[model samples]
Target: AIAGWTPVLDVCVITGEDGPHTALVISAGGVVSDAVAPPGTPHLRPETITLLSALLIGDWAVADASPDGARIEARGIVAAYAQFHLERSIRSLGHIDRTE
Candidate 1:
């Protein structure tokens, strides 16, 4: 089975050197196995991804503390998407835990 402190697993879509690429992994803690992404997966910029990650863990204010209008829009989109998925995952896990 996969190991380590991965309470959350997220993907950052980036414009890599080799055209549009999806992040296989990022940040601290653990390895990724059997990583795969189909073609044309939607992706956000790295800055947006960072903001989204921070927001996911309830640090939205810190991310948005000082940013321009463009930055604000990007962060908002990424943050919204990230929060939805993360919360859904947490609820699913909680349900599984309770049922067990």
Candidate 2:
């Protein structure tokens, strides 16, 4: 039984070209947590954080106005993360032998 196993959503935002990135994790219980970058990782500016937060909350207005590079990087990161998470979850459920 996969007890207490709830889906989690992780979002990462990159400030700009070669800029620092920050990640946020939201659990199925609606709990939000911040994921810090490892040591030596560049720190993001307060404005960058705010912009990313807006993007995270579905603020299309802000997203539409954001720099192209930043927006594109954010989208790519999100897509990659979603794919990896989905694959991991499917694998954890075990494999089924279709051949009888």
Name the top lDDT candidate: 2
Off by over 4 Å in 2: 1-36, 39-52, 88-100
Q: After superposition, which runs of candidate 1 have C-alpha atoms over 4 Å from their true positions? A: 1-35, 65-100
Q: Write the per-residue lDDT of candidate 2 for residues 1-100, one digit (tens) a residue.
A: 0343332222333222232334333222211223443344433333444455566566878766776556544444444345455554444223543232
What is the Cα-based TM-score of model 1? 0.35
Per-residue lDDT for 15-66 in model 1, tens only? 2233223233332221122334434433445555455456547787867663
Candidate of highest TM-score: 2
Task: Report the Cα lDDT for residue 31, model 2.
Answer: 18
User: What's each prediction's TM-score?
Assistant: 0.35, 0.39
Question: How many clashing residue pairs appear in each of the predictions shown?
Answer: 0, 0
CA lDDT, every model vs. true structure:
0.40, 0.41
Q: What is the overall TM-score of model 2 with all chains considered together?
A: 0.39
